[model samples]
Target: MILETSVVPRDSAEPCADRLVLGEHVLGVADGATKKPWDTGPDGAELAEAVAGHLAATAAGCPAREAVDGATALVRGLLGDAGVGSAVSFCVLHLGRREIWRVGEGRVLLDGLPVPPRPSGERIVAEARALVLRRHLADDVPEATLRADDPGRAAVQELLRALVGLRNRPDPRYGYGALDGQDVPDLFVEVVPVPGGVREVVITTDGYPEPAPTLAEAERLLAQRLARDPLMLDPPETKGKRPAANSFDDRAYLRVAL
Candidate 1:
């Protein structure tokens, strides 16, 4: 298996705050969103890379689950008080199989197949803090349950819709409930199998698409590129999100070839 990373910063001088690591059995990336328009910096990505690198170093020496748990804890510790957090997305490729743990809105393309949705309640609450503020309601808060009608699912979908709709319209006096004025990150994890006959896997942040691209399209494109020129699979300057003054968010990605 092989791992490659590519990022497009919001500005020329801003360092890409995206990070990734490729373990013998796992590979992943973390993208930190910058709230300030012209500010380019690293937030949780650094912590994520550190933890992922540690997992990679010990993958063969330990159980994959244990390694992943350890890495997660390490990253959590690193971001404890940095005032920097992230939307976490990770994929582990195990013995001819892959599984993903996803927190936020990142994408995972497996053998060209899209990762299935995993409900995230805490993450929804976190976003509410960022968007709604004093207007955020208790009913709006996400409940920690996996099934539908779950408070978390409802809160997240509503909050996200409001965010997308309100992004283009700025109003300083926005109101939300409980978590009125605070910052929070989107997070998730993804896993992929790297058994023989597998082609490729792609992971990317939400900023790359208006409405996220279909899994089939991503798979077809990646497969075709690999067949025509494998080297292009890991190009020096890969296609990334183009920067704009009013861009919704930053974009980042990781590509694994097997």
Candidate 2:
């Protein structure tokens, strides 16, 4: 039984980059990345929708890993060179074997504990922001105006790009993986086994601040957190925009049970 499933967008104007697919025996969730406004190609939401749809269409007969590979290939084919190179975090729940396969940042929670530890990129991103912030401070730029619209935004973005590129190499310590419109050799795939008697499992994107036993509780907690720290600036990790911008990333939550 599925207790509850939902995909919520951050704002009305922006497309919801998150997707949820429920097949006869397979369930999936995908979280799309946020692309820059200047990027004219397919956005993260489009990539996520296509990927999730392909996975659901073939999941009944295909193996989980194969389904993901196939979906990636199909999406690449469809986009071709015109692809914007956006990526998504995908999670699939196989009911037949009580197993889950997660790629990128989508999370699997069993009994309220994360199956695999969160990515180390969070700390890296925070550190990178601190470094960028220091550079901007030397230029006498205010922290509030450090978004894409600001004049100094380009320089800041350049610094972030260089730092992130250096850190995003294919290595255990820094290889942050995602389904970015390219072949990734160091894909982070986690296979988790469900507990013997556990009745339900929750898979979600990183939008939720933490895992909760129930989807409602998780949403409530996430909302509270967002209200208190909309920009996530307290610890800030490559998020937040100028005032009047969407405060949170796209969110998806799914609960499947026996």
TM-score of each prediction = 0.48, 0.81
Q: Model 2: per-residue lDDT, tens digit, 1-258?
A: 788888877776779999996777778698887775444567789889888887677545566567656766766675674234566678878887677877777767776667764364545565556566667657887656655343333434654454334332466765565565445443455667777787778888876657577888988887677677654555554665445555467778898876
Error of 1 at 243 (Å): 7.8
How large is the C-alpha RMSD of every model relative to the true structure?
Answer: 14.1, 3.7
- Mark the 10 consecutive residues where model 2 has the least summed lDDT: 147-156
Top-TM-score structure, candidate number: 2
Q: Which regions of candidate 1 are displaced past 4 Å? A: 1-5, 33-42, 61-64, 80-87, 95-104, 119-197, 210-247
Tens digit of lDDT per residue, candidate 1, span 48-146? 456456645654445544554565556546555322333233434442344453434556766666665443332333444333322333345422121
Computed on alpha carbons, the lDDT of every model, listed in order, comes to 0.42, 0.67
Where in model 2 is the C-alpha error above 4 Å? 37-40, 82-84, 117-122, 130-156, 159-169
Q: What TM-score quantifies how close candidate 2 is to the native fold?
A: 0.81
